[model samples]
Every structure is written in structure tokens, then in C-alpha cells.
Target: MTLVAIVLGAAVRPDGEASPTLRLRVEHAVALYHRGAVAAVCVTGGVGRHGPAEAEVAARLAMSLGVPERDVILEDRSRTTVENIAFARPLIGVHQVVLVSNRWHLPRAWVVARILGVRASVSGPRGRMSTSRTIAATLREVAALPSTVWRAWILSKRSAPKPEPRAR
Candidate 1:
């Protein structure tokens, strides 16, 4: 089975170029490809604030970084992190993957991926951080977690078997 790398996207510039966050995501996926850890990369995102499909920018970057064209699949209709995993599910099948994104974002992305039945491990770039940025992003993540977990719980309940009715 092929190993896939799932790279989530961020907003781009007005000129339809990749943001630093998105660029790093693409780079991490490419590095994983070079290391033989993954055989394909799925770039996931729809139109971001800058108006270009984020996956398209990522695919271009991946190709520029030497990942073969055939191995880079664009999932270009997802507007959110959950959508990223949900949209990539069919492409991924049962393959294992390195899920690439910023450190602060991957936890929620991982949670959503599991809910969608994708097997993945997180990979973020190694870098120095601004303490303020890290704390702010983390705080936002914590605020978002409850809704994601609640969605997981609700979906699980729906799939579970109903209990037998008690006798009158």
C-alpha cells in the first residue's frame, strides 16, 4: 500500500501565491516523500481569502520541490480543516500518512481525521516561534476543540446500534 502525505493549506497572498504556513506544509510533505516515508501527497483546501484554490498552490509547490506530478493529488474543494480530512478520505483509502500542518493546527486536524477514518500521524516544521503567536493560536484551538469533539461524539452515536427496547 502506498503511504500518502496529507498537507492542509493556509491562506495565500492576493497574487495567488502560497503563504509561509502553506509553503511549509508543502515542504514537509515533500520531505516525507523524499525520505520514502510516503508515496503520494494530497493537497487539501479550497479557495482561501486570496481567491486561489489552496491545493493548487500546494500542488505547484510540491512539483517545484520534485514530487512527481502523478503523485500529487489536489483536493481543491475543502474550506475547513474537517473538510480537508473528509475530502481526502477516498484518495487515502487505508494508507498511512504523515499529516502536515502547523503544530498548533494538527491536533484538531488529527481529531477530525480519526473521525473520518483516515490513519495519519502529524508532522510540523521545526522553527522558532513568537510566544504571543503560539499562545494565541493555542487559545483559539482550545476554544475550537469542544465543537470538534462534540461532532465526533455525535457521529459515533449515530453509527452505534440502538439498545433493545425494555419489556412493558
Candidate 2:
């Protein structure tokens, strides 16, 4: 089975540098590439307030880590988590995807991506995790749960095909 790594993006500084979270995502994706676990990586994000497009930063980082330029597919028009999955679906085609992101961000990402029509799995970076950041993210995710579910419902409804007309 073809497995494509999905390296989700985070903020980039005005200097066009990736955020720590984004860097971690790329690192994980690159590791997967080296392990032969992934055939390619799709880096997703649009232009942020302070930097170039997040996908651009991610793709560069992956390439620098020896992921190879040809193996990195940049989905550089997604400004939201929803857009991330929606936009990547086309570039990703029907490949099984392993998504890399912060631990606290994975559940919604998995659910949202599946609803958006991708077969996906999630992973957080290996090694030490800051408890404080996890706490903060956990709280935010808890708060966002209701609205996330609502949006998923609406999106699912929108993606559903309309009934075909009966024979005249």
C-alpha cells in the first residue's frame, strides 16, 4: 500500500522560519521517509500573517532533511485545519496517509480528515513533551470540540452526493 506522510503546518516567523511544532512535524515526516514507511510527504498550509506559506517552510525543511525535492508535495493554499485536509485530498489522491502534528491536535485532525475523505492515521513527535503546552492545547481542544463536531457535520453533509433524478 502507498503511504503518504501528511506534515501539518503551524505558524512561521516573519523571518520565514518554521515554528517548533512545524519543525517537529517535518522531522517526523522525514524520519518516516527514511524508514521507507512513507512514499512521499504532503506539506500543508497557506501564507501566514508573518511568514511565507506554511507548506513552503515545511517542504523546505523536509528537503533539507534529505526527503528529496521530488518527494515533497506542497499544498500551500490551506489556511485552516479544514482547508488542510480538503486541499490535500486532491494532491494525496487515494494513498493512505500518516499525519504528523502535535499530540493534542491529532484527534480532531484524524476525525476531520476522515470526514474530508482521506484514509489517515496520526502521530506526535517522539521524545520529551512539554506538560504546560500539552495542558494548554488540551484545554483549547476541549473547548473547540463542540464547534469542531458541528463543522464536521456540516462538511459531511456538503460532501454527500445529491440524489440522482428518477427516470422521466
Cα RMSDs, all models = 3.7, 1.7
Candidate 1: where are CA atoms >4 Å away? Answer: 151-168
Per-residue accuracy of model 2 over 1-168 as CA lDDT, tens digit each: 898888887899878999877898889889989999899999999998966999999999999999889899999998877778777878877647898887888888888877766788887786355788778888998788778767866877887789999998
lDDT of 1 by residue, 1-168 (tens): 777889987888899999878898889889989999888999999997887899999999999999999999989998878777767777766546778988998899888777755677998886446889889988999899988777765654675569999999
CA lDDT of 90 in candidate 2?
80
Candidate 2 TM-score, true structure as reference: 0.91
lDDT of each: 0.84, 0.84
Candidate with maximal TM-score: 2
Those runs of model 2 whose alpha carbons end farther than 4 Å from true positions after fitting are 127-129
Q: TM-score for every candidate vs. truth?
A: 0.86, 0.91
